[model samples]
Target: MDHHSSHFTQAFIHLDRLTHNMRLLQGLVGIRPLWPAIKANAYGHGAQIVGRHLVGLGYKTFCVAHVSEAIDLADAGLKATFIVLSATLPENSPYLVAYPCEPVVCTVEMVESLAGEAARTGKTISAHLKIDTGMGRVGIHPDAVADFLERCRNYPNVSIKGMMSHFPMADEADKSFSQQQIAQFHRTREVARSYGIRTFHFANSAAIFDLPDAHSDAVRPGISVYGLKPSHVMSNPQVDALQPVLEWKTRITFLKEVPAGTGLSYGHAFRTDRPSLIATIPLGYGDGMSRLLSNKLELLIGGVRCPQVGRICMDQCLVDVTALRGRVKLGDSVVIVGRQGREEITVDDLAQQLGTINYEIVTNIAGRVPRIPVGPSMAGASTESVGDDGTLKTLTER
Candidate 1:
């Protein structure tokens, strides 16, 4: 057995926190089946790991963006309902039939293709109809709901398991557009029910938090499970109780004293105003630390806030540590994306600084950062563990 040192930079995934967030969503949705979105590799948190953990915690359904993602979870022994939330292609039909995953049918052609494959295989194909109530990205139009359902109703091997739509702006404090979308969904549901279809769904993470009335049969919660709100306006009162599960961090690689006016990093974007001790951390845009954070973000070093001093490079960034009260040294840990004592750097904080959303902040973290599973010993464990080179290492060996 290889014994790696405890000083490697790694992402610390709080599994318990993930469960807690899921439970919180469940409590909020109240009896509406929770289909945790595991797409985009569980929002770059390792979909297989997060999916397995959630399945163990009694989450019976999962959502992904593609057929391959669904197959990955299935390969990971996820026996729960795996639904692909995007349109499927004809080329993917063979795998779709081979796997137990259900596809979200968005067009008449897709429905016919699935029906054909199911007939050939002598298997009942399960699918959810995506109704384009408002968001024009995917799904069949609401007006075509009756015709599409009627056309596919005669397919012997086709089973309509669900119906869903996406809300464009449920996160806004203004609910007028959201209400219109909901009304459209209701209209579509009525059309589907004319042919005896009952499984209806439309609320995503934002909708789940903002529009409780739209939790018809199930809720596909993506960001909320990771302990993030869809928008800042929707964060208070409704989703203030959610816990963030992913905590990003890295260790300080080395520390050096620079005289006043010393230019730091490439292009010399940052220059020392006064004599200062600059600590170089081994995570940059390559590891998902945004380049936009250059000189715009702060890292929690020893529970103290240290501002980034230069342009963030592909693999490293410099943080000013002169003002920090504690003794700064090489190999000391730094919290790039989580809490350190009373100093907490939230994704929202990063988003606000970077002029983006919390989703991009967390999901943009590069795949190289090893996500360490935080177990029951979470109380004593740092929100994140820092490695020697500042590359995140998993607490549990993968």
Candidate 2:
């Protein structure tokens, strides 16, 4: 079977914009290592593509959510140090030891298990000690940092190279809780320092913008690295400079004219007030376009903003393209989240409509939609051109 057949939707991963965002964040941290979070499949932007590009850009370290994710990237030849971010069980110690993964530790059993695995494999496993400064989620209590460090000394094979914490409300307009967290982290920093822990990382995407003091020894930036603000309330105006790296696009698959008073789609959720030209695009809730967005969203066709009418289906949605009746055609490019001429629809717009955050909007993009890497680096490489001009270019295999 031809896997590429009938696949109309794509998320264009702009490597240039990704590099720009990384450079912008790096400038703020200044020589401090910036460990870009490639977890959740690089926030659903295709981890393989994003990891490869970042590796080429001289990023020697990356943060992933799990040891398996790190293994997958490493197996794909992404040479880098993988810092596993989430808390895991003693059962996962073997995989962690087998791979180049440094997991964040919050429990004694996990540490002992890792030590056992490292001893058995004759390899030293470097790990980070997570302190629950204020997040109230994972990690040990702040007061227990010294004891944890002391206990960790028993496991010679399990080296605690770093100490870290997370901020719960760093993106909010109010910084009181974050400030307290940072203060608490400072006290724990002394403990880590006494224990000879060299790296102490605490800054995330929002903290990178609003909490300069929390920049610690290294920074782990997630959303900001993908050119997205942590929240609308970040204090730094420089957050606005981060360029979006992903653009979702599809093509007109089918079209027809409907007379006035005609009810369209399932449940008749929408009815034509006047004669309208309806265009079908191969995108739906199944493709990560929420069904709640039915008749509540707009797509770009021939640089014109066309209202998406009717109920969104599992594999298709209808766009009322009457405005572009004379200009649009079958296979014409449709901008789902990107610029078309002077008009644009952003991920933020979709999030607002869905009563969600930009992170959800981007990360929720379905897996089937192929991510095509683009930018100056990809200029001469094979790629498909599905533009509004209706010119079809053959898609090159990755």
Candidate 3:
């Protein structure tokens, strides 16, 4: 059976490259336990798939954004420690205590509420205290951490296992600000230690690659584990040796020749300068292919880069295939974000075109598109089987 016969568009995940990328991260973090962040559905790579692969590799700990994401893992029978990066609202997200998850709490009320839930459930909760050193997004103020710690001391059921902070400028060229944040985290660590909190982690993807000193007892890496550098500032090829594992592809459903100067697509924004062959593939902004990329992005068909022309449609886009008019045809493969022969489209390339980051490019891929694993499975992983839509049918689902 033809592989492309299933879904018109697909995202192939290379597990071998994922393993390579993870090993590189392991080397960077040294002895610090690496908590690979799988929030945002493993950054749109399918958390269930990636999480299962990681579990087979002997990786026991993972992190997600909320209680739901962690529960999704548990429901799928993926037994691994999950660290929920976001704080839990005891009134709303009491499910955090129901499942074994480590939630990051910053405010005193959050700490108290969580303690109350722990007492109600007659269970002990292992939580992380988030301190705001500089990120300004969440976490308690450095000056007020002591007061927050004191509040937590009232509840013996709440176990503050980790104290952490986020760095906003860790990827910036100017290291001065990051240095200050690092110093602040170090001071916070000392205070937390006095209160019996010993686990400390501060390094994100950028810091893991740039700041070795910030790799305390545990380190968190989100983007780099998938093999893309967090920022261009850390893109020195020699040191950052990570391989991107995503390959977005679609199949040509229709092909037609147009007269020279013929207008095309939604707005007639593009006209054939010469007699051209237009190929329409099943990819659109609805699938997280940003409409901003209209008439600007390129696709790799037949191992040749073809320019996307005219206004992108909601369900499809047109690519000018005049260069290989006779060589291409309906049902041919087109690569939206991956290699085709010697030509390839990297997520960084897409990010540069949209004036965004590589993270958005990969994470924006819609969950509907089937993510078919394209590499060898780990020893204990389920043998992957594609459903009619090209998505992996879970071992139990089969």
Candidate 4:
């Protein structure tokens, strides 16, 4: 599809901002390997596209939630080593070996399964062991680390090259808890080292900017690379250096005037007291715009904030533009999450309005929305279409 030749709601990937963020993150992270987490479809920035962008920018390591995500990236012709943060089953051993991925093993059972896969495939595979010092989600319990290590030593083909842990409160204002988690992680690393594990990585998006001590062998940054604070409470000088890489834009497809006391949208959620001009755009909850946003959100049109009226429909939304001095017209560009003329809407802003985090704002954007790369090299880039299930179609590279 010729992006320049059509008009539809689309998300634009700013390649230039992505480059800047990579450099800024690398600089802040020092010489440690920087693995940008591409899980959740690269936080809805389109994993395949972002993977290509990062590869072009000379990035060698990419991180994802599951090994399947890594396979998706590999299928796209991206040449990068992938680190799967989640556990991979023995049934998935072939995929782990077929693709350049290191899956995180968190249990003794997982260790045996992955090792069996490696032995059967006649290969030595690098895998990461996650320790649950504090984050009670996934990982070998601190008490079980000793036994888990012994199991790994039994299988020489399965090398434990990396040890990592997640920080549940790294983005919080208080550093005491995060400090404790890091300390616990360091102790676990020492115990594992007696058995030969060396690589250590703990810093997530929040820690990459807030916790320098966690910046061990590698730093995995997810949200900050897209220029949104990990949480409202987290910020630093280096955090400001990152840039937003996505912009959601759509053109007004319909407009109309309503008399006083007229209700708008489904269930008449928004009713006008005075005369009003309402504008409608072809974007709705189906596009991943949360239905929860209903009457509580605002969109930018002609550089002004237009209150979203009524409940957002499945394929359309109504915005109140009655406050504008001039008449509201059709075919105007509406900014759902980006800049418009002199004003800008941010992921943080949208997240705040919806009572969520920046991560949800970007990742929730459905894959059906096509992604177009904007910046240098874009002329040679092909527009990408994401499946309803987040399957990224191949981009016709020039």
CA deviation > 4 Å runs, candidate 4: 2-7, 325-327, 377-398
lDDT of prediction 2: 0.88
Deviation (Å) of 140 in candidate 2: 0.6
Give the higher-lDDT candidate: 2 or 4.
2
Give the TM-score comparing model 3 with the true structure, all chains together: 0.94
Candidate 1 wrongly placed segments (more than 4 Å)? 1-7, 377-398
Q: Each prediction's Cα RMSD?
A: 3.9, 4.0, 2.8, 2.6
Model 4: which residue pairs collide? none
User: Tens-digit lDDT track for model 3 on 124-217?
Assistant: 8898989888898889888887777887899888899989999998888877898899998898788788888889989998888888879999
Find the 10 residues in a row with the least total lDDT in model 2: 384-393
Q: What TM value does model 1 have?
A: 0.91
Q: Write the per-residue lDDT of candidate 4 for residues 309-385, one digit (tens) a residue.
A: 89999889998887774845778888999988788889888888888888888888876677777776422344454
TM value for model 2:
0.94
* Candidate 1 weakest ten by summed lDDT: 377-386
Q: Deviation in angstroms for 262 in model 2? A: 1.9
Top-lDDT candidate index: 2
Q: For each candidate, what is the lDDT?
A: 0.79, 0.88, 0.83, 0.82
Q: How many residue pairs clash in each candidate?
A: 14, 0, 0, 0
- Looking at candidate 1, what is the lDDT of residue 389? 32
Estimated TM-score for each candidate: 0.91, 0.94, 0.94, 0.93
